[model samples]
Target: MHQIKRRSFLAATGAVLISPRLTAQPAEASQPGSLGASVTIEREPLHALPRTQYGHFLEHLGRCIKGGVWAEGESEDMFLGGIRRELLAEMRAVKPALIRYPGGCFADGYHWRDGIGPRSQRPLRKNLAWSRLGQKLGPEEDNHFGTDEFLRLCEELGAEPQLTANVGSGTAAEAAAWVEYTNGPKDSKWGSERVKNGHPEPYQVKYWFIGNEILGWHELGWQKPVQYVETLKRYAQAMRRVDPGIKLLASGTFGPNPNHAEIHQTLLQGAGDHFDYLSVHLYATEWVAPRNLWRYQILNRQRRPSRGLYYEIMAALSVQQQYLEDCISDLRQFSPAGKPIKLSFDEWNLWYRGYSDLYQSNFNLRDGLWVASALNLHHRYAQELELANISQMVNCLGLIVSTNQGTFPTASALVFRIYTENVGDELLPSQVDGPALPHPTGLPVLDVSATRQGDTLALFLVNRHLDAEVSSRCTCQGLQVGTVAKRVELHHPDAFKYNTYADPRALRISERSETLKVESDGAASRFSVQLPAHSLTCLVLEAKNL
Candidate 1:
């Protein structure tokens, strides 16, 4: 819909705003989609780009917790408390910034208490949301991987824990007590229970969201705006009473809907001063846009195997960004000026091959490109968007898929390695200039974002086009660069070939320092690289101001 509107406006105007960088010379235009692109970067930093933006979401659904993080039964590479040593070791390799846990829709029905006590004694409950409302095709919630184990995992990986409170089937007091149990003194009721559970020290977990998706009908206790705000307010009040220092995120929109504006309006008009952040969840795993997303999420099947599905999925990044843009726009309209709520994309990923066995979907190099490019898109809005968690850290919609046998890093996991290793906290504002692809809308074939820390400048670029390689010319506008220190590219000829434990090289990162050519033009330092189709490139350069 956003794309249609964008294209219609472009068609009506008889011109697409090429942003000065996207337009090419007539001589360069002779080749099919030959885009003479440049990355004109400014010297000054935008702001502190939060590492939390590259956070992860680990749910209680399917093998995401069971076989994904915790070894299902018994394994030699197991950590102290059934946590897989290799899984955590691999996770640490990519550098998980923050981890949201226990639920997606599962949060609504999840009772944190059942999972906290003795693993053997802990009660087995219905896997409500993830298992089709407790019909129980697979095993029920075994309570093997619970609160303390989760925090232990967090401590192991050095990642912050962001727990979602159950508002769907639980009370405000329950939410607050969970906070107290984690962060309160041992003398307190729930905190004493935590001590009894063998943890004497407080975890001091800082991030807590109200619920997963309470606004949607699929949730256990879906509340309308008028009622939902009061529910949020009550939960916030209770939880904050326990730990005033804790940050909170409210359950937010799933996608662009007609109800989007009004819902935000009512949420703010009612609980304007309550939440620290408004949440958002989006995915490009689907091929076509659904008329009814709530139903579509459940239907869980690809409708469009159109010849252009790859491009459509790639182009959906703009739609995802636009969703945030519109959500924030609506938020600003009704939100308090002084205490403005930020954004938290707590649940998001590429998940379309709907479940049969453990919800493991199909993937290829295309998904990897989408993940890297999607991060690039998020980098552009890093100022307003503080945190985003790619859904399912392990199996369900995970970047790292594992089992009792062994584990292998998915193509998407490699994307995190490039960013976590090279991408910095300081955002170096950049623009990608290239040819426009007009299908759903006019969008550039090249996607990019830049950042610098200390002397190293990292350029994260993606050639979203499927066929042709983009010859990209880059320059730092107000600064001079010293040398092309490092160049890494993720590319493969086939989009569908994947890596297993036996053969993990089908999708991998290439360290090609020769691909980057550096030359000085008077005062400006310029570098050029041939970006291949369906590729993610990171150029780490030694940079200095002239």
Candidate 2:
């Protein structure tokens, strides 16, 4: 038997343990590979990267809301507000701009009334939507983390509250009342009820989602495209009657699924005039049978670079991006009046592998790289994507995982922070000239996106190569490349490595300042960077002149 460190053993076996630091120091510089790429970032801005694009989601199902975020027992500190203090601190650090609550499938069945009263008085209802496989009802949903709690959590985290209303089993009047309760004046009936619940002032939630995946077969109240269009229009009209100022989002297709084209067409034809944003959900995963879970795990452990899983995932995203563009084009044709219908990619992540339940997913270093690539895709379609949320904030495909000891920010969370915390405001046009990979979809091994915020120019590069590092040179055409301010690289020796509760620092981000030799050619400036194999790197450069 091999002798392993206690923490390493525990981590390998999926045990929780806390680490002293979230990120580790960089490894020593080594010989670079022969692959060379050049990224040219156009200084002229294309579009503004909306802060809401960095939003997160919180669903009522699983441990995401219950044990993960809201604590049940007494805390040593009263000010902790019954929620996990550590989770709260971690959320604050990541600084998500917006958080959508009570949802995915849970939104279809949730009632606002059940969650608003005092904790003891709140009802324990059966979660009909997100139940275990072969089981009619999932877990007993104790309405502990209801509307008030979600709003309070958002407030605590300094995130804008985006609420999803129940349209499946809920009445239009109920949906209207929820809007009133959240945004109406205290004199209003539902608003007065909200005031009585201790929040005298309205929560003033700005974004409201009509339903969640109402067209999917697994959804609680699955309906045809035509049926959902009418349902969405009714819900939108009623809700907006109460507060017309609130932005309404209608549930959209799962991206590029042929079966959903009708849904997209019907939605634009019928409900397009009512809603401001069309919400799309995408989850990337290599499917395997539930019975073959153990076998799949073994195979995953032994899988080689030939698997091409990473490239496949990136290519799939590109396909989805094209699908989104097609949807936008359809929207343009449907509403010739030029009524803008932005996409709200509210639920997205890599969630293929299942554990005790379908909602749970294991996050690894590869998943972090996948997330980085996904963020890059979002940047590519920044103009179309008004808002996006990484599904289930604390658990259930969450970026941060909660344990009994505390909360651990996973590899995905670090990637989220690296982009959400450091990426610039204005997205710049960037083109990568590099060798293509062997995948059927010939995507460059070097994936890159650039942004400019005032005097700072940030380049987000993802080396999609599974085995080889790329030494790349970046050229800024519009702006002169000044001194390198920060270079944050996230990579692990083994792509399979992940951050577990016991080893929270296993796959961590490493940040360091790099000396850049800026060569100025009459109009453009160029600098060099080395992207490690299977790594996500963000280089922030200070422009020569503001």
Candidate 3:
């Protein structure tokens, strides 16, 4: 069980030979100090900051399901049959609050009966784990966009469809008849094959991540956390004997693999009461090669993009927010607080696979300010993030990018459509005395987050200075600001500028509406904005209380 096959092929081909180097540092400019933010509008609330943490992953690998969100032999006009009405209007403009499906490591060699009925009677095979990580559309797959075309693109992006079952070459009765063919009902038995394939309600797919990254031996059921905790309690008791209100996530990891915390303490002492979410899978890569790895990714392939790969992926957002704050303190020291388990950043972004191509991504503006500073640490650890996708949405490392002449939106999907159009509802509490990046835990140069709702608030900034501008300031205590309704910016002076199909508004999303000069001094309300130098902002202020 020494499955360290070159750290599972450099964490499944984001081929890195070690990084934070495409070379070119110093000159990220602004560091002459002084740049603050003190938010703290607390009337009582610290948990839950979810927009499912801005979710969005959909894998069938590269061209993320042939030609980005399916539509192969071309045929658009009112879509849905080929589901690419511009990838459903840029995934209903990044309002996605969960969409993982069919796979990453192709859901343990998927086989929900070769993708449920009609699509000219499916059955073509060969797309085994992205045709062995190369997937040039060859490596066949006529299982045309299967599973009722991925729940009709999550029922046209209202979202929530997580579903990644197929623990390495399937079965607990074929993943419990694919959770009774998507949340069973109509006279059971695979829900009467989803009411004979034409869907009769029940797409009740409330998430299910069972296996993907099965303790990586380049996964395909790469067991070891004590035989994947009894094959995850025989596939969670045969998919809860066909749906016990779904949920489940499991395939977790929190390590540099020294038995990664004894494989998360043997999946929380063997299948921690079945599961509610653990599904980790990060990617802000490294480990380049002690082995060939496809000739060191075709002999060092990384011909562009720098600021040392944008401060080594914005210092891997403070090294994956200290590996998800030590994975929420290893889920409060290994579960059992009456069966709790949340944290499903079900696959993040920024890969290397030696400068991707087959996993297509040219995403920039420093990968949209590293996805708006990784959603300001998922809105400051949004109550242990039950789900947080974004591994793919269209092209492979997507946020919307596809070419043969269409689809755009990647300044990391317009910083996820300006944080899903400013989602707020409490989770506020900010404190920043900025101008950082001198390591040893100092990454800030103004990365922040604050949310509210009634009386609006929703701040969310990220100005990692490439040539200085910050000056910022937002003191606010317990709220009271009164005007400045929206800002939404996704600046670009080219941190490897993106948005192409011959310039899809060459780096768009500018939005405006200003007015915030508040100055109360009765111990709170203060404001002063001006952050732009490799930006990504979002204001919204019009507060209350005080």
Residue by residue across 1-546, what tens digits does model 1's lDDT show?
012232121122111111212111111212334556887888889888899998998877777776667764576557845777777777998899999988787788899999888788989887766555223222477888899989988888889999999988999999999999999999999999999988899999999989877887667777877888999899999999999999988877776666788888888778878888888776544322222345344333322222255665576666676777887787678777788788887766665533432354435677788888778877777777898998767877778877765777888898889889898879887887778764456778888888999877888988877667889988887677865467888888765567776786578888866534567766777877778877888888878886
Per-residue alpha-carbon lDDT of model 2 for 202-285, expressed as tens digits?
A: 888999988887776656677888898888888888988898888988888764565455667788778788888988876654
RMSD of 1: 7.4
| TM-score, candidate number 3 | 0.34
Q: Worst ten-residue run, lDDT, model 1?
A: 14-23
TM-score for each model: 0.88, 0.89, 0.34
Tens-digit per-residue lDDT, 369-438, candidate 3: 8778887787778777757887877877777876567887778888888888886856777777756754
Q: In model 3, how many backbone clashes occur? A: 4
Model 1 accuracy (lDDT, Cα): 0.75
Top-TM-score candidate index = 2
Instruction: Give the poorly placed runs of model 2, Cα more than 4 Å off.
Output: 1-32, 78-80, 132-137, 288-315, 355-359, 544-546
The lDDT-based order of candidates, best leading, equals 1, 2, 3
